[model samples]
Target: MQHYQVKSVDTKHFRLTQADTEIGELEYDSWFSFTAEIMLADRTRYAIQPKGFWGTTIEIKD
Candidate 1:
C-alpha cells in the first residue's frame, strides 16, 4: 500500500511526501481555502482545487 505523509512547512504551506520523496505542496489562501500542486513520478504536474467548504472534494482535470 502507498501512503502519503503531510508535514507543516509553515502557517500557510504544507509539504506532501511519499516514501520520503517530495510529491507536492498544499498552499492555503487563508486559514481555510487551499490549492494543491502535485507532481507525479512521471513528472506530470497537476493543480487541484477545492470545490466546497472544508475541501469536501477536490477538482482535478486532465
Candidate 2:
C-alpha cells in the first residue's frame, strides 16, 4: 500500500519525503507552483507559490 511518507511537519507546512529526498509538500492550503529539477529526471520540486493568496492558480515556467 502507498502512504504519504511525511518527513517533516510544522505549523505552516508539511513535507512528504522518500529515498532521503523531498518529493512533495502541503503548505496549509497555500499556493504553489511546479518546479522541476534540471538534473533529476522524473523528479520535481513544488515551492510555495509566492505572493499569492490561497486558491490562486500559478503558471509554470520551463
Candidate 3:
C-alpha cells in the first residue's frame, strides 16, 4: 500500500510530501463544501481529509 502526506491546503494548491520530498500537488476546490471553519487554538489534535480519492491517505509533517 502507498501512503501520502498532506502538507498544506489553501486557495492555491494542496502540497503533498512523500519520501522526504514533494511528491504531488493539486489545485482544486470543487469536491467539498465546508463552512463555519474556525481557527484551531491548538493545531495538534485535528486531522483532515486530503484531496486525494480512491484509497489515498494524508499525514502532517510536524
Candidate 4:
C-alpha cells in the first residue's frame, strides 16, 4: 500500500505529498465536485476528477 500525506492549504485547496515530497494538489470545485492533479514517481502527471455523494470515485483526464 502507498501512503499519502494531505495538507490543507485553505478551504478550497490542499497539497498532496508522499515521503515528504510534493506529488500534487486537490482542489474543491463545489459541494460535490473536485479535481486532483497528481505527479507519479515516474514523473507522469495526471488530472483526476472525483465525483459522488462523497467523491469516492475518480475519472482520469488528460
The worst-scoring run of ten residues by lDDT in candidate 1 lies at: 32-41
Instruction: List the candidate 3 regions with Cα displacement exceeding 4 Å.
Output: 29-62
What TM-score does candidate 3 reach?
Answer: 0.35
Error of 1 at 13 (Å): 0.5
Model 4 CA deviation exceeding 4 Å by range: 31-58
Give the per-residue lDDT digits (tens) of candidate 4, residues 1-62: 99989998887677888899987776666445566565555567778787777778888876
- 1-62: candidate 2 lDDT, tens digit per residue: 65546643655455666665766665544223332222222465444332346545554334
Q: What's the CA RMSD for each of the models?
A: 3.2, 7.1, 13.7, 3.9
Tell me each candidate's TM-score: 0.56, 0.35, 0.35, 0.52
lDDT of each: 0.73, 0.46, 0.46, 0.74
Q: Any residue pairs clashing in model 4, and if so which?
A: none
lDDT of 1 by residue, 1-62 (tens): 88999899888778789999987776665665556565555667677787876777889744
Output the better candidate (2/4) by TM-score: 4
* Candidate with better lDDT, 3 vs 4: 4
